[model samples]
Target: MPDQASPAPVSTAIPPHRGGLPDPRHFDPVIFPGAEAGEVWPPTHFNFHAPWMHEAGLGFERDASGGIAVVRSFAHLRLLVDIETAHQLFDLAPGSRDFRLLRLIPAALRCVERIIPGDPMPGPLLDEEEEVPEEHHLYAATTAMVERLAGQAGEEGQALAEAMRRVPPGPGMFEAAVARCITRFGFPMATVAPLARRLQRLANAHARVLATAAAQPDYAAMEKVVLRTRQPLGADRGWVGGGLLTRAMDGLLPQISRPRRASTAILAAAEEAMRRPLPLEAPTRLILEQDGYRDRLLDISVFWRRLSAAWMTVDPDTTDRREIEALARNTLRRLSLTSLYRAPDEP
Candidate 1:
């Protein structure tokens, strides 16, 4: 017996809760469908000549000289979508009755509405609107684009300024455009895998409390999911207490951020940190291929994952119950292994 010290994987063993629930929960995990070896998260990439989150709300910061910056703002959106997907998978599985895409789709839509005020280009994406939707939720894109198309003055760069001046999308229209983006993204599945797994961990722990209420026919778990959708583990600290992921991604208000680019020294230090390796054989080496900021961002993001994992496990009180603690540790360890190595299939 090779140190049966580590317990069995929860993925394989169904929880023998033995409580009065009929039928085992059938969850065709929406997190990521396949063996865990070679999944590529395809970081926030999208179909566009220009890069921008179609209809998402996030924080931003600019420099003294003025320039564009992208922020990591999808955490909340990721979790709600993750858990909702989890709920559907566990509740409906495949071949079940019409589980009502309306149910989950609308809930996911609400997340977009609540977060994005107007479908204004998330950040600098405000311009470049070639074809305006016959009707777009965030017409600011149209306004901005029209301005740019109208043209900038010889000296004023009036086009850019004018585009920035356009009013944002109406509140009502915001949801429609974001809905379009979700349809395009096909649910935040790859992005939110970490989130879904965290929710699985949470829903499992909250079962005692939630199950009691779930037993009541009129119980409102959907609302709970709405209000309680926090960012997942290994998320930015700004996510604590309901802060937006963009706030974290934007890297603090302009007043307080470090000189990221200037410190070639820091980038080098961080880059060197990546020279080491992690366990298990993943299949993608994304860092090697990404150009410009993605490389630095990946390094920072990977470090955050490593640092947080180390800290979270130390405080056992914060961990799942003892029975599942080992499983949780094992699961997290497997994920952490990804941070150390470029997966074999990242090309």
Candidate 2:
């Protein structure tokens, strides 16, 4: 987390490949192809997902070639690192390229020695039974802690939800409810403050879109609001990345078969209202029909619990403690809270 006035220059040396395949004989084939095993790989690849590894001078090069060589080398690294360790270090799945790469390391290492003449071969291959990496105990422990916190937060949210339902809908009321959740639940302000603000902003946008569509009853106007209000609901946003919200949406939402179809569906009821003289509440009701608010509330609740668990798992005296804290702080900063709330403007 120490500020470097200038970032270290990235190596432009491409990893050596034959027939567009990574040459396993080369040291650090996935990252620095011509360099030795002890040489440092570029830190850029792990900048976001595995910053601890980057700080430790371990990480592959970010390559886009999609060649067999890079893939093979990556597989080798994954096997070398093992699954439980990889998970603790970075978000990786058993079906991931890293996981699948384990099968290729032995062959790759043998080929590497034949090509390089004196390069050290990889250690003996792991048996199939041995290949199954151990569970990430830390994550398991963290999840237990998170569940306890979530139970407490969920009760607070339930209370707020009850109060919220009783009050008539009005401007700033949703924001007030969100503020109350943060205060009553005792969620970390550094993280929850920004997320609550974003939820409020999205609620405001939803409200505005409904109001505008109801008042004007035009497809073009409604479409503009839809486009303007659309927010990124994916893993690219930090903290939310690899979290429950990302999982729920990725698991539940149908794949994009056509451009803007999902967004259109979100506004479909509003579009219908454009042609029919429906009640003022109709468009907003239709928007809620998609369960957007419900999902968001769930996401908010889960995010805090996960973050709290992560905080609980860290030990201040550990070697990577600073890195862990830095990672958490950086992710919180990148939660994109600042961009969420905006003044309503003509679309």
Best of the candidates, lDDT: 2
lDDT of each: 0.27, 0.31
lDDT score at residue 49, model 1, on the 0-100 scale: 24
List TM-scores for all candidates, in order: 0.18, 0.19
lDDT value, candidate 1, whole model: 0.27
Which residue window of length 10 is worst by lDDT in model 2? 125-134
**Alpha carbon deviation, residue 139, candidate 2 (Å):** 39
Predicted candidate 1 versus true structure: per-residue lDDT over 1-347, tens digit per residue: 57657776568544431222211122111121111345332112222221232334432222233221223466643222332343243344321111221122222221122322222221111111122112232242234322432352221223222323443443233234234334543444343333223322222222222221111111123222212222233253432432433333132223111222222333343233223332102202312321222333333222222122222112112222231223223323333333223332232
Give all candidate RMSDs, comma-separated: 23.5, 26.9
lDDT of 1 at 317: 20
Model 2 Cα lDDT, one tens digit per residue, 104-169:
322223212221212232222111111111123222222322233334334443444443444344
- List the lowest-lDDT window of 10 residues for candidate 1: 210-219
